[model samples]
Target chain A: MQKVFGRPKGLTEIPFHYCPGCTHGIIHRLIGEVLEELNIIEDTIGVAPVGCAGFSLDFFSCDFVGAAHGRAQAVATGIKRALPDRIVFTYQGDGDIAAIGTSHAIHVAARGEKITSIMVNNAIYGMTGGQMAPTTLTGQVTTTSPYGRDNGVAGFPLDLPKAIATFDGAVYVASVSVDSPKNILQAKKAIKKAFRVQQAGLGFALVSILSTCPTNWGMSPVDSLKWLQEKMIPVYQMGEIKVAEEVKGL
Target chain B: MSKVLLKGNEAIAEAAMRAGCKLFFGYPITPSTEIIEYLAKHLPEAGGTVLQAECEVAAINMCFGAAAAGARVMTASSSPGISLKQEGISYLAANELPVVIVNINRTGPGLGGLGPTQSDYFQSTRGGGHGDYRLIVLAPSKAQELYDLTMEAFDLADKYRNPVLILADGFLGQMMEPVLLKEKKEGNLPPKDWQTDGCKGRAKRKIASYFLVNELAEEACQRWQAKYDQIKEAEQRWESFYADDAEYLLVGYGTCGRIAKSVVLNARKQGMKLGLIRPITLWPFPVKAFTSHFDGIKGIVTVELNAGQMIEDVKLAVNCRVPVHLYKRQGGMLPHEREILKFVGQVFNLPVRGEA
Candidate 1:
């Protein structure tokens, strides 16, 4: 008997601590596999943001620095600057990257820091319950926006990858999804390409993956996938949003 | 061993370089801006890196990143800027990463003037950020002490795996004085066993402050607290002047300490039996130094550039064994030597004239 699939070498044996039906595990697996496929697991330094993504330090078998909320890009910049030869990446959640760390996102891109960032966007803050996040869909219901996200009051959902793609320093800006097997494979490809971009010392690279928080969204695992496809895919422009001609072949 | 005249800020920058600090990240703030400016021009020539961060918040966090990557890093700012850096400093302290932070103390409560003040004694001594942590605060009185203490600060930070702050005032930072700079001390650091450089063929490492599990978090907190306790015992430094047979003790630090020394000199010449105790390490508070002089002192007068913040620590050290007094000049104003001397004479009921 042959086992066609096994745990990626980038992931540790420890089980993830995410809530049931959460897609964080899927995104983590994709990233872990990407790290292994890129042959960067040994030379990588990961920065984990505060929130559910913060536990990435324990799940990845690489050097990790747990950063303060929204400071993942800043920390990643520091680590990458200090050790230019080492590959550095930051794993962050929507709340960690978009809500509180928006300035870091804009500035890190503007400066074109040579590091990789993976933002798991679930449209809600999962670690602190179903709170409204920067990517919370318009008219969507969450704990913070109980009456549904009113664009008039809460403002419209931020299409971050599209916004980031405008920055010249962001050589590779990808908005991916892990809602299906095909999308999962595409997510892995984007994640791998992001790391490869870092390996080549290209400017900043970011892969924002549309993930699902089933426990927070009051949906089953199957329905969460359906909701992400039906709702999120329409809002956030999917596929590679930005690719510098310098790394177009990569 | 030739002495060179340098501003206090530049002296700290040079001394840091001499101590093998190769990374400096900072934002410009008054009085402390020269440190970053000097590093920007010189660190590149010394095969180091200097980054002008967007803000103090980013600068301190960058220090955390550089320090975690096994670089001797530093950041400098003034009072308002230091306030902006508190969050990152808390993270550094909690993670037990070593870095140097220089606070050229300026007047504050709100964006105050760019004059010297000791108002941040509480902010530096008592943890400025949110957490159960302590920064090893070194208060330097002059350019020479600033250079010496900046060099010592790097070693102390690495030794304890904690942040060390050089707490200076605006006057000390802006003033220029002759200092005998030491030769570059290379190869003094031990290998950083816990740096997050890479995990290839080695056990994985984490630079983090979070412990989600209840018992593990409690245990980690206890371990960090134990480190603070050990630091307090091993690093309480102070200097005493003319205290062998003195009756009055003038307690001060930074610029105030230098001022108190002059008061001691003039009062002793007038047969006033006064002495000075200058706390070099502000965090450990040098309680033992205060206790040692409690036996013969009639009073402890704390002279500060703020509204009597360190006076509380002095009173705590005295424990009512002797009368404790405070002479303060608030909001960037400095206390004159004669004013401190007059306050000392009144505390001891001595003659107000120079004949005391």
Candidate 2:
């Protein structure tokens, strides 16, 4: 109770505009905490994709560049390449990253740019009003998939962290959820690892956090996090999928 | 200070290095790919940035990112690719960012042939992107000029706080010639204090075009137009040849200028009173010269690779002082020298040039 409850300095003093009990605030805090702890707030540059979190430029104290729709990976790659001495990362949502920007994310990793990515996997698109996200489970119901997503109709939900872990250019890959306090701690650790890996000059670190959207999911904050745990985690396991340090060869 | 037999592509690359261009974002397109490939191999070795972006849109956006960080960044593409990059170009212009772009034009309405052409003259010179904006466009004829123009391009871009286009043709990209690279010759044009280097100790700098209100955006556009007006006073450059006592003025830019140059020399040898007004900066369009030529010149013959883009501008500049004839050839190949001379002959109605 005495410690571990401090706020991140990387975030601005202004309150977030997200809805109450929305996990975006929690995830943003986790990333901000990592940036603050690493003392990278002043020099760290973030590429904010076009989504709900895309407005993060106004919230984060660090230098942030807003990318065009679904093009944050490419922007981050350019920013990191030009300012290789600084820490560069991107904050993207599932629709922004795994759906429209799948090619950019894959190619950015494949190119092995020394950058980190924080992909928020909320099974529905929040900013655009609860559309079926690329990570939407097969039987998930959203505004777009009102009858529950049929695999035959909408294709299978993409397992992003697992799919990205297979790429050889990725240095570290992990999936974490914000459903429980224990998982939040683990999520903090994963975000830290991504920043640390980028600091080490390793290539393309990604920490995919399973997030919640109360406003769009049409549920109370409690039910959304609970739904993510009961429904989303079975499709996306919350653990590290690939670790570069564990590989045998130098 | 390197003296190398460099092509236009290599010259721009070498000159960029001399100007401290450590970051390059480009997508591979014909004629312009050498600039991308050259940077790809060199930037990494020199502790710089080289990203072969996924598409022209992504590539220019990458340049936007790098330039936002105060990096001397550049991108190169052909006509069609430049079309794809138009939106980002407008954004960069709106944000008043310093970046260099090279368009090695091939014939194009769409995916036009890979052959060299000056068809993109209007695309590069005029505001191809949607905006009340202007880019300092340098049209280089020779490989050595490519080097000279590129070094100047960064300065012009920084001076205007805008993107500068090094508009070259495919022939210039491929043809080799001796180039003399310079170091810091522009005499410290300016430091990039306008860029966002995280604004460490200073007030945070915002690099964006987003405005919530239409009125605010319109005000920004007006401010941008003022910058353009100031740019015209400072950045207009052209090369005048045989302007003193010429009867006909042959006007062109990029590769067409070179062909027109040879034609000028040949016509001079034949004692035909012809002069070449080659616009080195295609954007400002040598309006002064275009207006001045009306006093004595019989006609202004405009040649281009495209159907008739720059000719319209030439006609506007002439303002009906003289007949502005459009001598255009589309497709990849250069207009036949004989065919052009025949048109020249018809202009004077003199013996029709070798039975044409």
Candidate 3:
């Protein structure tokens, strides 16, 4: 008998608390698989932010520190500075990274802290019952913006990866997706490269994953993936936003 | 150990490094920026690291992260900057992470002036941050005590797994005096068995302050309260001078404490029986130390740089046993020794030195 598929060794037996159709499960699996494949699971510290992503403290087998809302980058900066030999990563939601934590995000990249950050952009605040997010599209309707987001009043959706790519300190910046098997595989590759960038002692590395919030989006799990592909892929500008010459070789 | 003339802020930084603190995260602010600058130059050579964070908010969160990893971590800021750090401070308290926070307080109700003021007494002593939590607060009046208390702060923080604050004023931060710094601690201190280094051979551990279950959250709260109770019992620190056979007792802390001491000495020379009770540890309040001297004391005067914050605590300690008067200034004005003596003279109905 051949064993083909099983849970990654980096994940725990505890069941995920994410919504049934949430893409968080897929993204979590990709990260777990990457950790296992890198054989650095035991040497890594994961910082989990306050959101649906905050629950990652329980999901990862590696040591975890839970951060207050939007402060995961600052927390990760501390861990990496203290233990430079160990790998550090932060898992943050769009609201946690792009909204209240905007200053931390910009400065963390500016300071060139040698850590990895994964921004799960579901375009809406999932944990807080679908409030409008900084990444919400202009015409998107949310709990806070029931009449649809007005570009003039609410401002345009932030293109974070593109903005981050301009920072010289951020050596690697990639906007990935997990809408399908192919995109999931691509997301894993980007995540692994980001970790490798840290191992090489390069500057900051960020991988933004376009995730789906099925329950909050009022769509089926299957339809949520479709919405992400049809609606999000056009707006987010997928693929590598920036890669330094040193990082490109990796 | 040899004595060195160092400013209060530099002495604090040096003392922290000598006490085995290896990680310092801070943002630049007046009267306290020297601590960051000193550490940035010296900490890396000592095999530690100093990170200039994006802001005070980020600096404290950085401390939270490093402390969770079982490192001796710290952050220094002034009043306005400390206000920005309150959110992260509350989070650190909730997680029960041991870290040292230094508040070189300046005048503030908003972004007030950069001068010496004890305006942050209530903020520091009354759980400055949100939620129900207490930080071990130490008030040092001089550079020597600043060095000594900074060392003690690290041990106290680790001993109880709680945040310990060194509440100083801008004057204390800027003043220069001889200080005997401890030798750098060799090898490692006790193992932080609870640190989230890695779960290589053991079950995964999480350093988190959140508990969704109601009973679990209540248990966590009880745990923090129990620790605070133990600290309050074992860690009350104060100094009483001329308190024996004295009819009047003057109470103060930090810069005001030092000023009050001179007033007591001047009053005594003029044949007015006066004593001074200085609280070294502000959080524990030194209530027992102050109340014990109330037997024959006719009145107690609390001198402060704030309007009347510490007077409330003094009254509570005295429990109406004697009159508690407030001699105070605000907005960065230092209460002079002469002015304090005049106020004490008025409180006791004594003959004034200048009165004909």
Docking class of 1: high
Per-prediction TM-score to the true structure, in the order listed: 0.98, 0.91, 0.98
What lDDT does the true structure give each of the candidates?
A: 0.90, 0.82, 0.90
TM-score of chain A of each: 0.98, 0.95, 0.98
In model 1, which regions exceed 4 Å deviation? B184-190, B354-356
- Lowest lDDT 10-mer window, candidate 3 chain A? A76-85
Model 2 misplacement above 4 A: A1-7, A139-148, A246-250, B1-3, B40-49, B54-58, B129-132, B269-271, B347-356
| lDDT per residue as tens, model 1, B1-356 | 77999999999999999888999988998979999999999999999999887777778888989899988899999999999999999999998899999999889899998888988999999999997789999999999999999998999898898999999988999999999998755445666899999898898898888886889989988998899899889899999999768888999999988988888989887878889899999998899887787778888888888888998888887887788989999888888888888887787788757533
**Model no. 2, DockQ:** 0.45
Clash list (residue pairs), candidate 2: none
| Candidate 2 C-alpha lDDT tens digits along B1-356 | 67789878988888888788888888898978889888777878877767778788788888888888888889888888999889788878887888899998888787778787777777777778986777888899999899988988887887778899988878899999998777757565677776656647765555666666899988998898888888776666777788678888888887888888777777777778788888888887778776665678888888888788888878888777678887887787787666776798887675544632
Off by over 4 Å in 3: B184-190
TM-score of 3: 0.98
Error of 1 at A196 (Å): 0.7
Instruction: State the lDDT at B259 in candidate 1.
Output: 86
